[model samples]
Target: MMVKPLATNRSSSGMSTGKLAVWWLIASEIVIFGGVLASYLMFRLGHPEWGAAASHTNTWAGALNTMVLLTSSLSAVLAHQAAEQGDGKKAARFLYFTVLGALMFLVIKSFEWTHEIGLGFTLQSGGFWSFYYLAAGIHAAHVIAGAIIMIWVAAYAKRNEELQRVEYIGIYWHFVDIVWIFLFPLLYIAK
Candidate 1:
């Protein structure tokens, strides 16, 4: 007979394994974003001229994207709640709304980037543009990743009845939003 090992929920330190794992992941992410933002601040401080360069970015677009992300966070929370209630269908619906928000965010971002580049604001324009592209581009990538995760979570909820993970994914999705909350002010409104 083949023996199946039991998967325990408690870690060696007596912490809930899932929560500990999520916290570890979040801690690593903080290191990554923190390093990037610190470097950006250092550069911005050293080069006082970057202020005028920062002003060229569209504030309205940044504000709109912030709203989109905030709304997505709300949808993610709703999805998690539905999952907790064992309503897979409702969970899927809320997840779909979250995905739609990501799509909207990307569309707006695309237009904003194209318009800015058309106005001669390429990455080569200056150090500020470089950082702008780097920061926004990374945030957009995270948005894409979150959307993909949402789709998978929704599908799993539909067939596997595994809605408990909704909360985990929601936490990650909210982290992405929180990053944007800081990025918006640093890149768009700081100047």
Candidate 2:
């Protein structure tokens, strides 16, 4: 008996199936974040006092994390480039750098949060604190998830298997960074 080979489905939109799926995931994330941000903006406008609470946020820490994430994004882009060139080891190295950046960002965030909580800026402190925790917490979770995924991709990249995944992971990392870009300004610089 002969078996038929499975066929790959091409995207009608001219995108790779993997890339298209990533875009769809990002679109959904945008809606979730947009709703939260819109609600925060509405409440912030109605309760101007929220600005006073926001002022207490560590601007320096936020700025540092911004730089870290941006650097990580550059590494992710480089990983994709290396993967395209079929340099699996080089691609894996870049991915490791990206993961390191994520760790640095998380560390800075934890310190900032600890200081704020010590100063009585707990979630139950007020509406502003609640929103602050919710938004940043979700973003951190994404960062953690991205780092783990990158690590997995890096392992495969080193073996030259599934190299296309490097690009997909890069796309996801960029989205994560962009989210932080919006969040840093809103949470730390808006005051």
Candidate 3:
């Protein structure tokens, strides 16, 4: 006898269980990220002198990462399209490209952080620097987590199993990219 999870077999909602679960997770993540960003905004507005610390952020590196994330999002879109057409291999291939973009973004972020740290921009440097590291560090953690999950999803997709997961991870990846769109301007351009 074979048994599957009850959620897999039952769907009272119009959405698939996988989709609903992903959305639920995303909603929780939104609450967390929203709180952090909102707090940072309040702090930034209260202390104009923090602009000095903001000036230290690497706009070029941020811009480059923005492009990488956006491009990776495009690959995610393509992966979803392939999965919809029942081409799991193609979907997995696109997912791999998307992961490559994630790795590239992380590498650039590391170099930028190394340079800033070398120049004495530690988390304790100032109020703005503190929020900068907190917000950006959280975002970077999400990027790393997303990439790891994406790799696992891609492995299943390559085997033509759990193809619908392609869309779920794409949703999460887009959210990650959108966060960067917000962070890039706030962290890199507000100076």
The lDDT for every candidate, in the order shown, is: 0.88, 0.93, 0.93
Ten-residue region with minimum lDDT total, candidate 3: 2-11
List residue ranges in candidate 2 displaced over 4 A.
Answer: 1-9
Kindly list the per-residue Cα lDDT of model 1 for residues 1-191, writing each as its tens digit: 95434343445766555656767887888898888889999999899999999989889999999999999999999998888888888999999999999999999999999999999999899999999998888889989988998899899887646676787788889999999999999999978
Residue pairs in collision within model 1: none
- The sequence of per-residue lDDT tens digits that candidate 2 reaches over residues 118-172 is 9989999999999999999989999999999999999999999788899999999
Q: Estimate each model's TM-score.
A: 0.91, 0.94, 0.97
Which number leads on lDDT?
A: 3
User: Residues 1-191, candidate 3, lDDT per residue (tens digit)?
Assistant: 97879897477998889889999998998999899889999999999998888888889999999999999999999999999999999999999999999999999989999999999999999888888899999999999999999999999999998999999999999999988999999999999
Q: Give me the overall lDDT of model 3.
A: 0.93
Count clashes in each candidate, considering only residues at least 3 apart in sequence or on different chains: 0, 0, 0
Q: Is candidate 1 or candidate 3 better by TM-score?
A: 3
Using TM-score as the yardstick, the better of models 1 and 2 is: 2
